[model samples]
Target: MAYKKEHVKERFRPKPGKLLDQVREVMHYHHYAIRTEKTYIKWILDYIRFNGTRHPREMGKPEIERFLSHLAVNRKLAPSTQNQALHAIIFLYKYVLDMPLNDYIDATRSKKQKRLPRVLSQSEISEFFKHISGTKELMAKLLYGSGLRLMECIRLRVKDVDFENHQIIARDGKGGKDRATVLPKPIREDLRLHLKGVRKLFEQDLAEGRADVYMPHALAKKYSGAGKSWLWQWVFPAKNYSKDPRTKKIRRHHAHETGLQKAVANAAKKAGINKRVGPHVLRHSFATHMLEAGKDIRRVQELLGHADVRTTMIYTNVMITNFETLGSPLDNLDND
Candidate 1:
């Protein structure tokens, strides 16, 4: 008695599902990063909504190509946006349905345009700082003086700060590469006071059996007891505690970046900044101002942790106003 062909086919097919988490789990199985998981899930959702609730398994390569192409051509999206969507769909087919790519795709890929980033001047930065007050002032100082990204500033751990060495070790920074930056001398006293407050909080949490913070990926795997230790505590602890997604353990993490963002936004408005200002403006100010102070470009590049000096040179163009006093552009202007 042989089984029916339809029954065998149904059993072999991938288990159909509607819940988003099910699809997300398939992407996670490949050890893809959190950003990739988020992007892939979002694109899959967009693909579904774009076609008015069409099932992904039912759709073939043509439909996927059409969606990606539509994003590039119809939506007039930047190349990065289109490529992000492309990655999401690629993950969908490659991991979710166990389908290989590289067949029957007529997607139009957007080309990335090379554009220079905007930078701020030292005086402009000072003016910007004068308008900012409270915690935002410190956050700005860390961003500009340390050349830290906003997330990096917030994510800084207690142990990462080396007051004796006058350096701050940035762990799991952009690209998961660790590097050290100069800790501003001006803020050391204030920073010490701030950390004292953090230490007090740590003591309170320790008393309540809630001292542990987020740990390194392998650390959590190696020692189950490590999550509750003082060394694992976040230097800039979050107001609330959260359970680690990987370890299912509660720990205090860093302050939320959103709070800092909103604070900066409000401060910028009060400061009367005509141009748009953001947490990143401090970073732009850092690189540009360092170059203005006769610091060697290569040294600035090293301090910025740029992979290529050419990327760092873009600030030279942003600093055009600085050269206005270079023996005067009007020295020859009168004769001309």
Candidate 2:
């Protein structure tokens, strides 16, 4: 009897290096975001150190549970943070080591808390803007007007802003989804002048032979020279060239989020609003204000790029409630 030839597939093996390096190799192969790559690396390193430098392949579910329990009980890590650490370790074992964890991991979990997002009143927003000027001011306006997250506004490419259609295409937003949002008409001319300056900066970079901007996914490899194109240039490019953390190539990146964050905080303090404020408060204010204007909740959900309407519904809880209009029953009781 003749037996048919059986074909066996070989498992993936990373290039020989340090353990962390092999983890990075797998992450890079999967095209993880730079921020995600850094975060996962940090978590993975923390997990290994917590295990007393034991190889992950040598340990399994119980060790994983113990490490996570420590994070919850001792470190007091939030549910999201503990979960992130768990995911990083799972990636190390499943992807890099080719050892899939088949058993359930019943780790001690941090309890999730419900908190309402802080929102600014219209007058407070106006007062806040009075303190911030120049590039940061434009960014702040976009956050309130276009309902963009801080990084979405920062990572915006030149082509993403469509003045003709009065929309800004927010690409690769949370969950890697794209959505269009309103571009405030009041700032169009200011944005135009801003782009003129950005264009001049782009020209200068090209003249110096360092015009490349970071491209997402395989676009850099597929397009090859597209990174140097003006259309692909960052709307808010960093003032100085910095080495790419992954590639080590000198290139200009988007403006750091911390600068804008600090600017917003300072502006809030200067405006003398009592509640805590940051760049995201502007976004929250935008959502609440839009709803206050009687804009449809579903439409607001689309603009905010929330995957669930329930996430968008949180804004309704904080919407302005005029207690005086309701009239207290005590007022109805005549004073004898």
Per-candidate Cα lDDT values, in order, are 0.73, 0.90
lDDT of 1 by residue, 1-336 (tens): 011111111112234665466565554443445656677778889987887788776776778778887888788888767766766666566555656465656778765577766566556677777777766678778988988888789878777889999998877666567888889999999888888888888889888988766656456568887766655566677888887664577867678888888877777777666767778877877888888787899988877778789988988877656355667666778664
Candidate 2 lDDT, tens digit per residue, 44-138?
88878899988887888888899999999999988888888877777777778888777788888887788999999999998999999999999
Give the TM-score (vs. native) of candidate 1: 0.82
Q: Which residue ranges in model 2 land beyond 4 Å of their true spot?
A: 1-12, 329-336
> Which residue pairs of candidate 1 clash?
158-235
| Poorest lDDT segment (10 consecutive residues) of candidate 2 | 1-10
Residue 305 miss distance in model 1 (angstroms) = 3.5
TM-scores of the candidates in the order shown: 0.82, 0.94
Q: What are the candidates' C-alpha RMSDs?
A: 7.5, 5.9
